[model samples]
Target: MNSSRRAQAIAPFHVMDILARARALEAQGRDIIHLEIGEPDFPTPAPVARAAIEAIENGELHYTPALGLPQLREAIAGFYRKRYGVEVPAARIAVTTGASGALLLALGALLDAGDEILMADPGYPCNRHFASFIDARPVAIPVGPDTAFQLTAQLVERHWTENTKAVLLASPSNPTGTLARDEEIRGIAAWCAKRGATLIVDEIYHGLVYEAPPQTALAQAEEIVVINSFSKYFHMTGWRLGWLAAPAGLLGGIERLAQNLFLAPPTPAQFAALAAFSEETAAILEARRQELKARRDFLLPALRELGFGLSVAPQGAFYLYADVSRFSGDSFVFAERLLEQAGVAITPGVDFGAVAPQRHVRFAYTRPLPVLQEAVARIRRFLAERRA
Candidate 1:
């Protein structure tokens, strides 16, 4: 039997293929410097790990309420109150199975068959796929350095159609590491409100911003849905825990979706995440964020020196979306050759979207400073040899 049409329509996440190839090369004795995946290199903080161990030992493995444990939800709300100075009530929070689960619940709650959702091209690919899963149309608006590779209220207005039902966005977005300005977020939220359309903002990279403090979209508008994960800033990628804060009106529907789709998020993970907001964990996460910022500072100029066109400097996140047109017309081929010949693994832009993707590639500065330096050096030699 054939798979469903929706399953067939989902495009493969090409970075995973790049990662698998990189791993194979490593197994065959090649020194692979991974700049592809967007996961942090740091381990989960001590306090968070200890909490998980304690929970496991105490037999705290029973299923929690589908919406999540009451304490964990309150902790997430407290994070918003303390971190972003926004008061999100615990009742509005739903601890999800990673941001992916939150995205599914949000889309499932908002979209119906034949609806349309607007988002930026070269955005996180899964946003579109999530819409597709619901039989909704995903309209990708092309964005570039002109708008910091982000969506704006004006762009949303320009792209609005009779069938449009929602808008999805990410600050400190993957593949680009660019953030939408706070004012821009407010504008977009207002626009969506005026139209009675839903707006979902991915804030998984919230605490990882450099140059200035990060702002939550919830601060822009109380009605907006905010999705966050412990995976990024907390260095807990493997834990598969995330959460979403929705308006009080939407929480009931989201809870129903969460109940049916997820049953509940992992019990041990929920317990462990309680410590994610602790002061001790905060210090460790802050140090890792600084380390990531330094890597970005180094890789940005190094890649530019090697002839990659990086028009916008990323202010946060651990990725640099570089235009590789000068070196190679096709980013996928460039990435493959770089991996095979130079032992450096990066994601091709095609993985993000179809907006001039052939000319772009993404570098995730998730590796250490010295490892990034070595990747840069290898690319330098590879380019020189190709020129000769």
Candidate 2:
């Protein structure tokens, strides 16, 4: 009745909007300590930056093939081989503007209008937007702490329907930061295989995990879509570079979609991203990962000590999604109060889903240890005052 049904069906990302507001407030002289946005606070690795500069000076800055520069695709493919021990051909990889572009491309390639795609609730909100953008239904599978806030094989099986064409999942998930087990991934893949449903895995946070590295979805299914980015692990969010590795068959559709949608990833970013696979860069990023792990270690225990309950122990990513219902039932109100009263900004879990949304908040521990420690101290003071 009012505009396209698609537009009305989706919700805007509230946490990002709140983060923007908090940033604006900081710009107006408020000392808002940002734990809201999920961005790493590190500069890009020097080698990666140097590569982009060289490419710009050398004029390798023209539009590339839609499937991305062959060399970059080869590099991404090699990344899979070296990191995952999976033999992925360069032909199966497409460099997109970022993981965002990859999500759009994947949804366009796989979904038809009015089709249904299953994704875990309390998951990445953008997945729902992507599905809605393409006129597909994003069926939220209500996942909670009982399953580590993940979409398990049993849940997938229970939710499958005639219109369900795909299952989209993120490992080391965005809000909760919990990685799905390998066996769980395999089971979901096998279940999807039988039902002709596609499985999409978001591995953007793969390199940031504190525990052992996650088993990629590619290891389980030949037909799944895998997305990764240089934003999180490589500290290159502004670079806007990421890649998607799909089954050999899906390459044609994705390439065509990417060609028309993005033309190609940024020429300079792609060139720089090649160096992202270098040994020196790898070592540098590993060091950064260790630093993030340290920040997480500091923030996690401190939050618990200050009386915040965690839905799941985050084994990876730079986020700690804590249950703050004891302090304030409304996460948005609590986050706002934290920003205004305590100078600490955080993301409300309500942005992720409606299930117990008001009870949680996500704190990004990607900043330096001192920053996180200060934020924790401020939060403790705020909670202590509230209790009094």
Candidate 3:
């Protein structure tokens, strides 16, 4: 039997495969320090969890309007108003299953079959797959540490072809954890606006920032679509809830796609996420952010001391994309051996892109400080033993 060719064209999630191996090792009673996955080790904030419990008890799980719960949409808008001082009408927000759902809706509404969406390489693997799912091409612009692992206006201009449709970028990006500077995004938005191309910024890691707070694309350009989540900063990974804030001109098509795609996002998750923006929850998340920041600080220097080549400091999110070329020629082999021989798990850069794939690996600082310290000690010993 044959499956969809689209399914065939896409590659497997190599990180997940490594995770499965790690889990198998764990089941066999091996201790694995996981710096591989991007998920926050922290659970959902207590208030948010309680909200889900209450919603479930009340049986308030009915299908919401395809666009999402109006109150939640307003809450998201209100959040922008308070957090970024940007006024966004609730109607322009589409709450979907997750960031992936938001991406699906935006890509569906924006790109034609042959359209090309531009993004930085060494990016989230799912972003390109999301474009592929719609039969649109995702053009990867190779980015290094000089521009902080982000796309510059110049690179975007150089990559623009006749089929180019839009640009998608994530500030506090997944693998690298580097930000697209506010000025850089503004310049990209202006260029895209001039060309009549859409700019979609994935600001999911907004609240998770460690350095200076990142200004939202909505704050910079009123119409550039921004994708966000209750997952990362809110620490609600399993909730499967996120939102897309699009401009009024594109909301109708996005709404239609939302209506048909999944009927609505999980109802209970929406109810639960309502608590995510509250002051009590904010305090809790802030504390977790500090914990993550501490972990990042500890691991950054430790990796460098171990001879890892990292060009830029990760300003936000919980990842460090380190070049492992000094340690081994192939990062996949290095990652696998680290997991198997040293009981440490990290993601190979090949999972992110074809550009200099063998040279890099990403480490997530989602684990607690002590655990990270232990991982470092283990890695230090592993390198010493290998070199000896």
RMSD per candidate (Å) reads 0.9, 1.7, 0.9
Q: Which candidate model has the greater lDDT, 1 or 3?
A: 1
Per-model lDDT: 0.92, 0.88, 0.91
Number of clashing residue pairs in every model? 0, 0, 0
How close to the true structure is residue 252 of candidate 1, measured as C-alpha lDDT?
Answer: 88
Tens-digit lDDT string for candidate 2 (134-181): 889999988888999899999988988899899998999989999888
| Each prediction's TM-score versus the true structure | 0.98, 0.96, 0.98
Candidates 2 and 3, the one with greater lDDT: 3
Residues 131-157 of candidate 3 have per-residue lDDT tens digits of: 999989999999998899899888898
lDDT of 2: 0.88
lDDT of 1 by residue, 120-230 (tens): 999999899989888999999999999999999899999999888899999989878899988889998888888888889999887889888877899889888999998
Give candidate 1 misplaced runs (Cα > 4 Å).
Answer: none
Error of 1 at 43 (Å): 0.7
The TM-score between candidate 2 and the true structure equals 0.96
Error of 2 at 207 (Å): 0.7
Cα lDDT of model 3 overall? Answer: 0.91
